[model samples]
Target: MPGPPTIFVARQPIFDRRAAVHGYELLFRGSAENRFTGGDVESASAINIEQSTAAFGLDALVGERLAFVNLSRGALLQEFYRMLPSERTVIELLESVHGDAEVLEACRELKRRGYRLALDDFTDAPHSQPLLAYADIVKVDLRQTPEALTPGFTSRLRGKRLSLVAEKVETPQEHRRAMAAGYDLFQGYYFCQPEMIETRDLAPSQLSQMRFLAEVSRSEVSFEQLEELFRRDVAMTLRLLRYLNSAAFGWRHEIRSVGHALMLMGVRPLRKWAMMMGFLRLAGDKPHELAITALTRARFAEQLGPPAGLEHHDSELFLTGILSTAEAMLGRSLRDVLTALAVPDMVRTALLDGGSRLGAVLRIVMAYERGDWPTVESVRTECAVDERALTDAYVSSLQWAETSAAA
Candidate 1:
């Protein structure tokens, strides 16, 4: 007999103008298939939500922020969203859902219950015009909404009741244009791109983080050296010990010193932990979501390392994933960041060219982050891992990132 279905869920952060995460658009897949191939999308969505919420509390995936969940016409009519807390859930009506009387009545009922409504893939078509009346948010796909139309289009939609959200925004320029066009909310991976400032020197704090990351990356760094490095920075030392002593580690006794923590964790684990801390430090003044994104990528790549045939190179895999966002975090080119850290050729190549098995793992992880399941499948096939493994790795990585952030 076959086992139960494998559910895949990944979140895309939605940001305000200040770049702070306002909520997440939870992308769900009922099976390993990249796209919903056959079954009723409504049933699949309802079942996936039931199972995901029961198995892993909604709090686990989104924390305290709102969860933007997509719903089909049937799911919306059936009131499936009622299963979730109305206050924290944003009922996103898929573009396929029509705005007829029944649909509008369903939306009105949802509004009466204090649930916000969002219209996804919004367009200027007459079919979508009626939705503007009830929708609290209108998500405009910038890719489909032509550049010349943005100013006038956004101006037309700008109103006191509804806020405009710029979707598929992928660069700093796109983000700026969206803001200039009066978009109140923004989506997409634009924040992940490094803002390159020509001829700017690295900040002193970032330079210090680089030195620590470089030291940990060295193959022969000793416990004493690491201890001394931690010792020099009292705040970092406390954070390291505090993290080790957290419930996630579950040490029988309280970890007292940097030396004790280093000895217990050994070189490999210590290196990974220090690298994570280093990344957090390097991510100064950036959105908290950026740090979580890097951490999730790190853990996801690390979890997939063995399956991707890099079992012995987990440290390098973790580094490859975490540093993938270094350019964005530190405002330097990826090449410069890698060169400064003097990472191994394997890690450098993986981050730069996406070459080698390490690169395959990083590719899969990055694609999964964007809900690009087709690319995930292509790379997963290349790596010879099954869909369940990737999905499981992603779920666990999400949990691990949440824990690590709190720690």
Candidate 2:
């Protein structure tokens, strides 16, 4: 069967004074591979937001936590903000939104309907003051606003009964400054940076599992080839048999040998299973999210393969996704990890440089994950996949990851 279409959504956490997660600002990219054109921003934002909410549902995107969604001036005027639950939804108006009569009326209506409003990238300009009357929160871009101006900015708004949100808080010092400046909330990458850890040599078992994964990823494999590798580790042998006989598979007869399991589970399923198992075994003390990310990327790439004219080489695409994060997950450079795993030149080129079709798709996946909607749109146009296909693939990948993590 063909894989799912690609759709991408990313959430940036918002923190309160105590440094606890208060809510998330959900960012949407319409297509997994496409960039937004210089067309109507309101229409594009609305389309992407609607597509994402339809695919994942609002609860799946933000869980029980509150969610902040950006509303273009057009969306606000049209009352699209009313679609979401008011108690947990914060309707964010862009700074570019003019405080015209229509917009101000929309803001008043939204507040009257019990929807909290935020002004994104707030600047204390004369144009923004009119909207401030309805804004419950104001986000100041620390990167763009000078430190000297921040105190006066907050001081001026002190009587407005609005919460101050310090956006683009990129450092510990900036976080402290924002707090001192009377900001009530914070948002940025200061707290999400990965800790650098010393790289270590792989254990014998891990090395074996790596080799086993490499073998599974190959184009052709025989029962003897799989059985020989399975016999080297008793645990792997049991895992294979158990998976094949599990209720999910529902085979008519019980499997008795590794060969039987291999025959029952086709090459594609076997390869995915082996790859997932290998990653689980190798991810020692690593964050569980890394595994989830790798698996999701793998499924996403595989789903994109056929549409990109790589129908016969989906396994390679899957491996490309899985190995893309090896550096971060293993605390080693990608070049070194790929060299050790003996990945093909095509996969290597895709990872090192965006030179091939697979490389283009991989780039799209990475950009989408980071919420880089423009890059995603450009890459999607370059790769020639439609928005619906890409969005479906991404949503399917998320569903797959959720199921795999639970399993």
lDDT of 2 by residue, 53-77 (tens): 4334565566677888888876675
TM-score of candidate 2 to 2 decimals: 0.46
lDDT of 1 by residue, 138-207 (tens): 9989888785236777777775467888898888898888888889899877754211111111122464
TM-score of each: 0.45, 0.46
Residue 387's lDDT within candidate 1 is 91
Clash count for each candidate, listed in order shown: 0, 18
Evaluated at residue 104, the lDDT of candidate 2 is 94
Number of clashes found in candidate 1: 0
Query: Model 1 compared with the native: what TM-score?
Result: 0.45
